[model samples]
Target: MEMVLEFLGNIPWWGWILAVIVLVFLYDILQKKHTILHNFPVVGHFRYLLESIGPELRQYIVANNREELPFNRIERSWIYASAKNENNYEGFGTDRDIYEPNYIFVKNAMMPFKVENKHPNQKDPYFLACAKIMGEGRRRRPYRPASVINVSAMSFGSLSARAVESLNKGCQLSHAYHNTGEGGLSPYHKKGGDVVFHFGTGYFGVRDDDGNFSMEKMKKLVAENPQVRAIEVKLSQGAKPGKGGVLPGSKITAEIAEIRHVPIGKDVLSPPSHSAFKGVDGLVEFVENIAEATGLPVGIKAAIGKLEDWQALVTIMAETGKGPDFISIDGGEGGTGAAPPSFADHVALPWIYGFSAVYQLFKKHNLTERVVFVGSGKLGFPAKAVMAFAMGVDCINVAREAMLSIGCIQAQICHTNHCPSGVATQSKWKQRGINIEDKSIRTSFYFKNFRKELLEMTHAAGYEHPAQFTMDDVDMATGDKNMINTLADVYHYHKVAVPFTGIKDIMNCPHLGGGYEPKKEKKDVKKAIKNEEVRY
Candidate 1:
């Protein structure tokens, strides 16, 4: 042993370093989870290390200011400036392509109406008004929403405890509401902020052992948490319309399991549709039931698809006069922690289109007075918020922007459960990077500046209140000989047409194959008419 120790002590420093590298290379080859590491040994770690920082590299170096997906550098810079309450002016003019299709511009008033020049009040604006839902139910009186842009549906399970705490604290300071996205109701949500308790297909906070909605549990929840200002029943989110919400088992803690009433270490799947309600009638009744139980305003959140289906729901409301107090319209461009590519990309209508269609429906049926609209999906800026208001959305919901305010670096690794920025993971070590107090202050500042800028635009448009903005205040840049057209001219009406009738009436359609058959009744239709009939 003394001879061996003497030999090791005699080794040079370079020799010791080489030996350590050789051992690590052997360990890498022995590992099975990563095929790259197995094939390349120690050299492969560089790929992963570089991949981990790939987003930052692209954001800062490779990608130009305007050439990024989901969000660009220009947009992110504005958010950062607002969060820090710093000057966000560009040195030169915009780098945006003004001649691009779908470009938007706000029409300023030549002679703007001047309201009292007052300090940015910082008071929570009474933005929305709710109608009475249930009769003689001992419910809390409906209070006006504090701000136009409030935190959107971000589940507690998708974010760490510290992240949720900071969000709640910031919301409390800003007099805004924090939405408890379909995960479950947790203690971290009750940090003195107004809460919007959302129920997805899982019914996480109010479900029984059999995974069914429980009225008794809901009643208990209402009795305990009076800070819950509203309830949002999520029909579908824009990012993944027909897919259920999936929380990987690795992110779930024992406390999360208890809160959600699920088994520990099991992936939690919220079904695509609600089990508590069946049809339109059933849905209206469910809304009434929750409103009655909690005495708080109730609403539904959905990504718009199947125009007929949405019209039918609103028509029933007009007929029965019993429905949700508000509707949250999610645009197809909305972000998510995780989603299937097909559903996220091609399923639902964009925010402006969905909002316009839904608004037209409400107006058509004369139900606009009863139902308020909350528009969501990438609405993080003042101009975008104004555009939504101009199109009849009562308020807006900000999710990604709020995360940015509290230090999400757009790493886009939220689903991996290894978010390096500490805003979207369960790892205690990662969360330690976040300072709650500092982030909370930044969140409040971001929200205040957002509201202030929106109001400024409202006043510049010669409108006293943002709600007064109409189609005349905004334009869609067409980039034609005539540069732009008012929103009213572009989206004047929701045209109704007979869909797929052409296919049914075509005489000997060129596209027809031998398998084609006339559309007929189920009783008369058969896959194969006789035993001799062949089918693919």
Candidate 2:
């Protein structure tokens, strides 16, 4: 016993350190996966440690405010500040390069429309409702959206239950609708918000035992969830337009399996195309059947590619008057879901091109008034929202912006199921970080602030509502700083006027109509007089 104890005590601290280095060196050299580790051995371990945290380091220390991709630091800061109800205003001059190519410039009016009761403490002072009533033309159960901006499609399975619950509660508070992504309607989505139930090829919530879309199942699901105000059939998403997704068996929990109606411990495959319908004609018929059966507005969402199918669909709708109540055009840049690099980068047409082309087609067919137009793809910002409205979008959906409002740090590791912020991951321990009550309040604040800024910008442009903004109101700068053209000139299509009867129709508030009122606010008499002189 004395010999063994003496031998153990004889090993010094330096010897222990040396043994660890030897072990690490041998392990690194033996590993075949990493070339750096194989060549450099022990020293390569530091390289990996630094590389793993490279994104965080770049985000916090290296990259400037406007240099980051996707959502820049400046953009994220604004969202976070707005969510927290902090002062989001910047003191210095604009940091953006105003003369850059494709720079959007909103022409302000000489006589800005005076907003009355601007700081009302009521629940919803700025009633930014959509111009057209969904399903009104088809004699279905028509609904008027309470807000122009709403939460976009984000599935419960893709996000944590707490995150979904927070978003729904936030939507309820802000009077915005929540679009349930194709993952199906879990209990988290029923938290008092109006819902736009969305289904893709897999038809998770409305599938039969055989995994086919069942009309009876759809009807029952809709009936049970009265909050589901509309149905959206997703043709394709912006992330991967023609690709399908797989929910790996490892990610499928019992609750998820039940909600999605998929077998537990089995990889659920979502086919790229719908099994129930075949061509564009079949698609129209399918949409019509769903709308007719549910007596609710039904819509289609897609990222644009070849226009032949769109042309055919519009032609069918024009001829038959049986089609979707709304068409949501997702921009190629939009991506909340994980996708292959090639597909995400090269597949779909960007939002501006896709939206303009599709809108022009509908205009040509004289079907613009009959159908509502929704646009999504980084349109959550006030300026972007204004631009989208000018381009003839009736409503805008926000996905990642909503996530940011609820404490997402743009980790960009959403596909890994290890989202550090608990916003995107399904891990119970990770999700525990999301406090639903606190995050829900932040979500409501973010939505309200977004609408408030949008409305302010609308009034500044001499318009009562965003729907009244014409393409002539916005200008885009060409490569040369001196060269600029109106959006109408650039896009080669003028917006067809959609009737906006003011917020009174949606909110029953009498004071919500008109652009300017002289009698109510005599304080802006000089401004109003100057505005009158320049009035067209």
Candidate 3:
């Protein structure tokens, strides 16, 4: 004990200084920046003050085995392994948070194999969501796929060029179509696969050299890719449905600005509403013009506001005898490129409520035959997709899940653009740190397996085809643990077709293949051009 005290007492006062020096040194090396702590000394020495992803970082760099740590490491590695078709198992043991809530297991018993075949003969369902716009003079039309799933909008610009390429390849492999996010179509989009080019208000893919919308240019571009199956005008989205995107100037490279036709360093604002189409008539006109120009499927994506607003759209469709090919509905949970917190938190309608309401309106308009519906917002699990299909959506789109497959730990830093995962970053150094090819392979495998799980889920539900799903298939569980068929209590009339679209053209659209990007013909919306201004 005396010796221990002597050792402690003998410690020099300057020893503390040496320890601080060591910490600063380690921080510098870890940060790879000599100047990070030059002025601030001990405090400023450590640049980033957040919780270090210590175990995750080690798995990526040191362990090299990929899926090692719980949160970040092994999960991304598993995806990478699956994407590349590499060996998936690690001899170590099961890696997951087993204690998480509702961590149930499959009661796979010796049930007859015939149980899996129950839905094998079921047929695909169809939707008819047709509508017309107001100002543009043409009617909008959209078509839903026969089967249930389609690649949600994930543009090359919003994602990395490599990420887009891999996803397109996976889409082709999975026999699915990929939606181009609001980002314009770039070379990365054409992975020799089917793509739905989503046009935001920016006119990304169709912009001419001067960055203006060129109908001729759009026609040519659409013709070039036979995979360009559909066109979507993004009116709004689930996450920031009414909010325009804000591309930090750093991310807006010359090429991107040229494609989007917006100024560099300026916040790229796609105004919440389309000025060219004030009333329902104008909305229908634009849809018709694009359909005529493209000779392919076209639709819109948006969030539902007041009932009267959507009813107004139905009325316009009936009055003009024109409608969109389909409507892609965004829920309050839909993810966006970036948005202000307030708008994301408070603006949009939940998917189930919004989708059902719109589905009823389509039935009422009698336009449901030619148009289709695409659903988004939290489509990560097989059960989630199945429930949505039963509720009424024709197809499902997923965003954050795809990111997770490609190694996003939901760090909530996507808008910052300094993604450590190669999938989201453009920085060669940061991206280089992540093996793109490996991660892509993982992404493909994860999704493929997930689809199989969907099939399994449906089989368990006593359904075969994805289209056989209906509201009755989904049951609501009461607080008392009692279950009741949705048909007993859910409203069916809400989904019926509407004759009088009660409000202005409903601003909601779907985003399965992509989003709707309305064209603004009126140079300035403030000055009166022709008709009376629409009252808020």
Q: lDDT values of the candidates? A: 0.76, 0.86, 0.59
TM-score of 1: 0.83
lDDT by residue (tens digit), candidate 3, 279-304 = 66677777777777765567788877
Better of 1 and 2 by TM-score: 2
Tens-digit lDDT string for candidate 1 (43-64): 8989999987887899889999
- The C-alpha local distance difference test score for the whole of candidate 1 amounts to 0.76
Q: What are the clash counts of all predictions, listed in order?
A: 0, 0, 73
Candidate 2 per-residue lDDT over residues 459-509, each given as its tens digit: 999987899999999999987645999999899999999886755554553
Residue pairs in candidate 2 whose N, alpha carbon or C atoms collide under 3 angstroms: none
Q: Which residue segments of model 2 deviate by more than 4 Å?
A: 30-33, 118-122, 480-482, 509-536
lDDT-based ranking, best first?
2, 1, 3
Total backbone collisions, model 3: 73
User: What ranges in model 1 sit over 4 Å off?
Assistant: 1-49, 118-140, 479-482, 494-536
Q: Cα lDDT for residue 102, model 3?
A: 27
Best by TM-score: 2
By lDDT, who's the top model here?
A: 2
The global Cα lDDT (0 to 1) of model 2 is 0.86
